[model samples]
Target chain A: MEVYHLYSGGKDSSLAAYILRKIGYEVKLVTINFGVLDSWKYAKETAEILGFPHEVVFLDREILEKAADMCIKDGHPTNAIQFIHEKALEEVAKLEGVERISDGTRRDDRVPLLDQRKTRSLEDRFNVQYIRPLLGLGYKTIRELTERLFIVEVKESEKLEKSDYEVELRHLLRERGIDPLTIFPKKHLQSRVIGWKKEKAHL
Target chain B: MEVYHLYSGGKDSSLAAYILRKIGYEVKLVTINFGVLDSWKYAKETAEILGFPHEVVFLDREILEKAADMCIKDGHPTNAIQFIHEKALEEVAKLEGVERISDGTRRDDRVPLLDQRKTRSLEDRFNVQYIRPLLGLGYKTIRELTERLFIVEVKESEKLEKSDYEVELRHLLRERGIDPLTIFPKKHLQSRVIGWKKEKAHL
Candidate 1:
């Protein structure tokens, strides 16, 4: 009854972990690291704040490089981010004792999204349950829940420091003398769950 | 926050109510009664065993009649059941102080299924959140979770005395001199959650 949730140190994934635990699953927050930077540490810190055991799974560095190339070629990050996400899920699915894997992808998410067909295929191949607790909840409901349950810090996507795949992808572009801002979209605000509203912890 | 879950005394909806409560929502199980039969009482009893408040919302008898007519004409119960399910949700959505509504429709449900567009429309029109916690879980995962968490009785569809919409629909057809077996598919097994597995209740 343990589910390894893909953690990004953000409100949505944090909430997914919370809901999974509430519904009787032991949640282990996992951040996939690809050697691009120590980004997973940020997620580890947030996981500690949320009071869940945290782990860093090492994905092939080549995968991040390929995603970076795709981002640079398309000047958009959607496809590349989605690529990394699927790879991360596959890695988790292959882990021992990991019969259930989950992510925070919501109904309104455009990037890093797994459609039902892909989800089913993963479940069938790995004999694991791929749970997306937020898939049925829309933007309005998610915002309302997070506002009540989490202490979040919102900043421009470029300035925000978190363990989501985007952080490493952006760094890869920078290493290759490319400004991530050019390939990555502008004016996007990202949120990081710094802590919980302690009063609502028991609820 | 409180959610009015469409309860049928079946494992799916019962689990939905349990999950909603575990996630910090006060759940009130609402069984929509069209007065075709007193089937809602069955759901009320199960809700009592699960330790949640229960209420019966009466819908227009005309709606059930219309669904029965559809069943007789088509010689199949799919469209008829879907019609009644939609009507039931509408009745719940229109209730005063009902800001959130939920159902047990799972990933593989065909009849009475609400596609994203239809769900969004209901939410927009009613100004309420339509929650479906089981929509992302496929048959295997759901069966596993229910077996672990609930004490359920499995019986042939016709013999199962539960509060699901199909029960009332069958009664309506029978009242109109139809065998109900002629229009409803056979050999389908239905489940009723008689109680929770006491040892796993808190989890």
Candidate 2:
């Protein structure tokens, strides 16, 4: 009945939230925060601009330090990554009576850990349906869509290996073992704004 | 002012076509078949049943054959997939005054070459808009949305990957993918029945 979107304050998550609303789903944005990060601020701002309620969950500091380690290019979704998402959704799903827990993970991601490993398993085990709206889309296309719609700020990536298709900077960097990238205030252009970037920080 | 659907006789495409029409677009269904493939017959049948003008184009082979390498996967679209899709749109783009090419490519593709690549490129290059009403939807959700409304029978996929997401189906497949996966056929299901088989080799 009700849907809760997994909001990360990055482009992918924000787009998922936006697209969910477009498709006529009653969506509530939930953010999983480690408590000590600027990413949470962006997530909060996104929820405000998009007109969705934001839920923040604090993760264990010890577990978070392992993010860089667990986020290895080849070994994503380490038990730690899956544990955090499932944990967050497990809590979110119970409160809102949400049947679906959605995310912004795109198709270009080769994070073996998330796609084929724990993320998939958690989806079935959590009894919470997971939806990735950007799964069939690439980075460039989303850039166009977001710009055309005039959505809030730039998409952040987490350092990633380069591929022909552009993934969100956050996801891209994350795969390469780093925190997500963030760009604020950004740019001004009419036609050429299809591909815009302000400043990317590896947080 | 007018938009048409790149219909593939599948559920998502059909639903997309119907939605665009409801939204007041002068919607039409276009299906492209490779040389002698019987994809045409089903497209015709589907168009007839659904009450739309179906246009069939035989490319013998379209682009993306070498780029994305079509034979690599069944339901999944690979890199350069968008290149081929735009090539299809290019042919369709040539239609007198058609300005927008809508497709059934949804939001949940494992690889998003089409929507992210082809769709965006065409919007800029051809200066025509590309619409995917199902851009943010996963297969299960699309199925639910289709059922909630009185939408008619459409194709899911041709025979290959058989993930049941595509709109084209091979005659050898007997059962409908929906009945087992979802609830239907109660009495209203009669109208949805489409037993399409090849009366000849060349469609």
Which one is best on TM-score? 1
**Tens-digit lDDT track of model 1 for B2-75:** 89999999999988788788887889999989887899999999999889999999999999899989999999
Q: Give a tens-digit lDDT track for model 2, residues B19-133.
A: 5654335777787755434646666676676677877765534242343233233333334445455566777777778777777776555443363454566667776666666
lDDT of 1 by residue, A92-155 (tens): 9999989999989887788778777888899999999988888778888788888888999999
What digit string (tens of lDDT, one per residue) describes model 2 on residues A83-155? 4555565666555456787777665554311443454465566666666666655555566655545434322
Error of 1 at A41 (Å): 0.5
- The window of 10 residues in a row where model 1 chain A has the poorest summed lDDT is A194-203
Against the true structure, whose DockQ is highest? 1
